[model samples]
Target: MKNTILILFITLLSVSCKKEPQYLVKIEGKQLPISAEIASDKTIEDFILPYKEKVEAEMNTVLSYTPKDLVRIDGKLESSLGNLMADLCFERANPVFNSRTGKNIDFAMLNFGGIRAGITKGDIKTINAFNLMPFENSLVVVEMTAEKVTELAKYLIAQNKAHPISKQLNLIVEANEYNLTIHNLPLDDSKTYFVLTSDYLQNGGDNMVFFKDPVKLFKLDYKVRNSIIDYFTEIDTIKVELDGRFTKEN
Candidate 1:
């Protein structure tokens, strides 16, 4: 009986030892370059060829033509490219917002940093639109009171950067006071204005806190990139110029 009990104990100890856990060993190395001498995988190439061809064809499709090059330059209160984009956004989004909410878009505002690239003086392709506004920001309308509109103007004056504003706005910065007009009229402190901008800006991007807590927020479900593409497709020739929409005087 003793010998049988001892044999059972030894068996249990052996099973527990066998069940001990093991750890994984890690090895790290730098990525190696892929050489042209590598054998091409025929199956993979055949699978990707059709998709590649379709993408190339779409990107190369001409949408419109620009008479002159529109560039985003530094230290300028406004640029041809910025004016063109802001005007296009307002034009495209106004009708949509009006139809949905029965209110017209008073003006449009966009950040200067958002304009990625300049449009060359030549045939404008779909790829150019994508390159200009790479972000997938959607169009949004913020209904703000007259007080908030004043805040908006102040923010612009303080920034003193070449941000894009629609033609509807005529802002003149004086030494201590700012003269702002929307649609060629003075801002009414009791009125509510529908301002068209990107969802990013509406959410306080670029320190535009005045856009926050608006009276009404309308999402247009329209991508800014798509709006540009639509505008280019509709117009045969794209003409843009700096018209001194926002000016400073001491």
Candidate 2:
């Protein structure tokens, strides 16, 4: 009996000592290595490349299908705003998903830098999507307010060309100053707005701290890129016609 118990105990110990598998992310360039993962194993050869290939494949699937991108707003301001929204979305699939699991989400936001590619009159592809936003960014949603929207607009104008905004925004470059209409809109303090954004901004990485204001802050379970991908896919048909409704410029 004693011998059997000892054997069982040894087996349990060995099992516990075994390492589980995981995906690993390695960052070089800095002195200290930045290592992380969404998987279990940490070895570069064992995990990172394959996982990356899988993600890339997934991204390519939808990206390859998009024919062309379009922006149709009533005025230059609205048009610019629409362009910005679309550009930011092109950065990723912008999926709205479950919050607890860091899944794709509904209604997301993208920054202008992500819109790296200009849609020409032709078929769009994964390469095009990659060209638009090459970074390994995820999607996120925030709870904001109309007041916060005003702040965002003011921040954009105040920063002028320096502001990292979506293509949806328009600034009058010649005047050396940009005007904002957000201030003109009345902001109710208690009203909350669901603002979907890229994961980069939520973690204080984007310097858009106003998004984190205590009163206006509500975190949502969503990834902007993934959700955006879902949206595009759901649309089924590709339609590109010039509405000529740029809202921001006018």
Highest-lDDT candidate = 1
For candidate 1, which ten residues in a row score worst on lDDT? Answer: 70-79
TM-score of each: 0.89, 0.47
lDDT of 2 by residue, 1-250 (tens): 9999999999999999999997768856757555674455557667678888887776566432335444322232333434434444533433222335354322334444444445444454445445555666665556666577667656555543222334333334225444432213334566654555666776665566656753433344334434345445555545533232222242
What is residue 110's positional error in candidate 1, in angstroms? 0.4
Where model 2 places Cα greater than 4 Å from the true spot, the runs are: 1-109, 145-147, 160-186, 214-222, 237-250
Candidate whose TM-score is highest:
1
Task: Give me the displacement of residue 63 in model 1, in angstroms.
Answer: 0.7
Residue pairs with clashing backbones, model 1: none
Model 1, 11-111: lDDT tens per residue? Answer: 99898789667787897889878999888999999999999999999989999999888887733788888999999999999999989878899999999
- Residue 194 of model 1, lDDT score: 91
Error of 2 at 234 (Å): 2.6
What are the Cα lDDT values of the candidates?
0.92, 0.48
